[model samples]
Target: IALECILLLILQQIAAPGPQESADDSPGIALAWKAHQIIRSRFHLPLSTAVLAKELHCNADYLGRVYRRTFRLTLTEAIHRQRVLAAEKLLISNSLSLTEVARQCGFSDTSYFRQIFRKHTGLTPAGWKQRYCKEHINS
Candidate 1:
């Protein structure tokens, strides 16, 4: 919701409504959006703050600071969050193995994937999948 609001505000500021309107020409919103989009779109890849900064042509610290300030979370956190979300869907709907899910969701190790998934959802992937499947079956 906050992200949507920022996008809307950026859109509104991009084109002034009146002849005397003052458009806020700050690139911070756009840059922040770009970083968010990259995380969302490329969550399956091995990405880092330095890699993102290089792609955006900015210093790593500056990018992290700006992203944190704009979104109230670090870019790394956002990426992990997104990856876990994606993994949930894959786990529930697909018959892929745990290692495959982890690999597809940008995790290099299955243990790490389980650790992160457990951290976010408080359930192991297999446990979550079992519960989800049972619920759907009963539904």
Candidate 2:
């Protein structure tokens, strides 16, 4: 009986995430990880805070608060960052025009896409393309 109890305690300790932790414990790190998964999987779609909250099984306000705290940026800002990074890559491809790049990155308006791109990069889409082209030629 003593050996059985000892073995059970050892197994439980080994299975736990940390000291004083319960098996059902959900930490901020876990929540942040789930949030990242949800964003990556659904980011290209037109999604609202309510929709993301529902998908994550949290309140919109709470989700936004925790997400911003965890990522140091608001949910909308994070999505925009992702979209603009994608747009920058697309701009380099030379196969797709700015309109197509905007559409592919889930931007509903080309003008809005250009605006956001410029806001994040300090350069408009055309300027970014031109700078990259100039750098390549100089190299």
Query: Stretches of candidate 2 above 4 Å error?
Result: 1-26
- TM-scores of all models? 0.80, 0.75
Cα lDDT for residue 134, candidate 2:
91
lDDT for model 2, on a 0 to 1 scale?
0.75
Per-residue lDDT of model 1, residues 50-129, tens digit only: 88889998888988876775677788888999999999999987899999999999999999899999999999999999
Model 2: how far is 69 from its true place, Å? 0.9
lDDT of 2 by residue, 1-139 (tens): 5985795467445434566655444454356457655665666677666777788787888777766655566778877887888888889886798899998887989999999999999999999988998999678
Cα RMSD to the true fold for all candidates: 5.3, 11.4
Clashes of each: 0, 0
Task: List clashing residue pairs in candidate 1.
Answer: none
